[model samples]
Target: MAKVLVIAGDFVEDYELMVPFQALQAMGHEVLAVCPDKSAGDKIKTAIHDFEGDQTYSEKPGHAFTLNASFADVSESQFDALVIPGGRAPEYLRLNPAVIDMVCAFAASAKPIAAICHGAQLLAAAKIIEGKKVSAYPACAPEVKLAGGDYADIAVDDAITDGNLVTAPAWPAHPAWLKQFNELLNK
Candidate 1:
């Protein structure tokens, strides 16, 4: 089983973070959930983003998710794959130099990387998606393109895999995202 590292932060989409973390474990993989400046047992608040009749997704307060590992303890080489969940969190997480470096390391190694929705913001900030076809929330398409990536305008429930990276637009694509990511891990 692969040891996967999930990088997340406060206000991360509720289902995007929780589902993968739990589902990966259920699939027999070892998963570690972490947040910047936080340690094991520490918690981060989540938000539920739902699509309604509005222009954008609606946000509601979600559960407090506990971190299972410390960000400072993360060593890129220690994990086999990386997962980045989408939400308002990525908007700020991209500003952290350490976070950018970490994402770069994962990309440099060609390890399996799964990013969804606003998580592309981090990939854009890291400047590691150049020439790759990446899918993210429609709002993030410009960033993906500006970062030199080919934005995949895929269905909300679909996912696309390019090389070692597997990306999707949102949590609705979880089934396809995880399936593709799991295949990459097994390879």
Candidate 2:
């Protein structure tokens, strides 16, 4: 079983954090859900981002997701893959040098890395998306381009995998996202 690391923080998308965490575990992969500055047993407040035909997605308070590991203790060598769930967390997480460094480490190792929605912000900040064919929430297109990555603004349920990276627009694309991510891990 692959040891998977999931990066999350306060306001991370509810379904984005829970579904992959549980699904990966059900598939027998060891998944570690963590947040910066948070230790094992700590809880992160999650937000529910739902589409309701508005100009933008709606956000609502969600459950607290518990972290099973400590970010300070994380080592890229101990994990086979990295998962970055999207939400408001990415906005500030991208500003953290430690988070960027960890992301760079994962990229350097060419391990499977999956990101969705605003999670791509971290990748953009790490300067690892350059020349990559990436897909993320439509709102992140400009950032992706600024980072020198090719952005694919496709359907909400579509996901794109390029090399060791898999990305999608949002949680609705979980099926495609997880499937591609699983294939990458098994490779």
Model 1, span 1-187: residue lDDT tens: 9999999999999999999999999999999999999999999999999999899999999999999999999989999999999999999999999999999999999999999999999999999999999999999999999999999999999999999989999999999999999999998
Candidate 1: residue 82 lDDT (0-100): 97
- Return the clash pairs for model 2, or none: none
Error of 1 at 40 (Å): 0.5
Instruction: Tell me how many clashing residue pairs each candidate has.
Output: 0, 0
RMSD of each: 0.5, 0.6
Model 2, span 1-187: residue lDDT tens: 8999999999999999999999999999999998899999999999999999998899999998989999999989999999999999999999999999999999999999999999999999999999999998888999999999999888999899999999999999999999999999887
Per-candidate TM equals: 0.99, 0.99
Instruction: Tell me how far the alpha carbon of residue 70 in candidate 1 is from the true structure, in angstroms, after superposition.
Output: 0.2
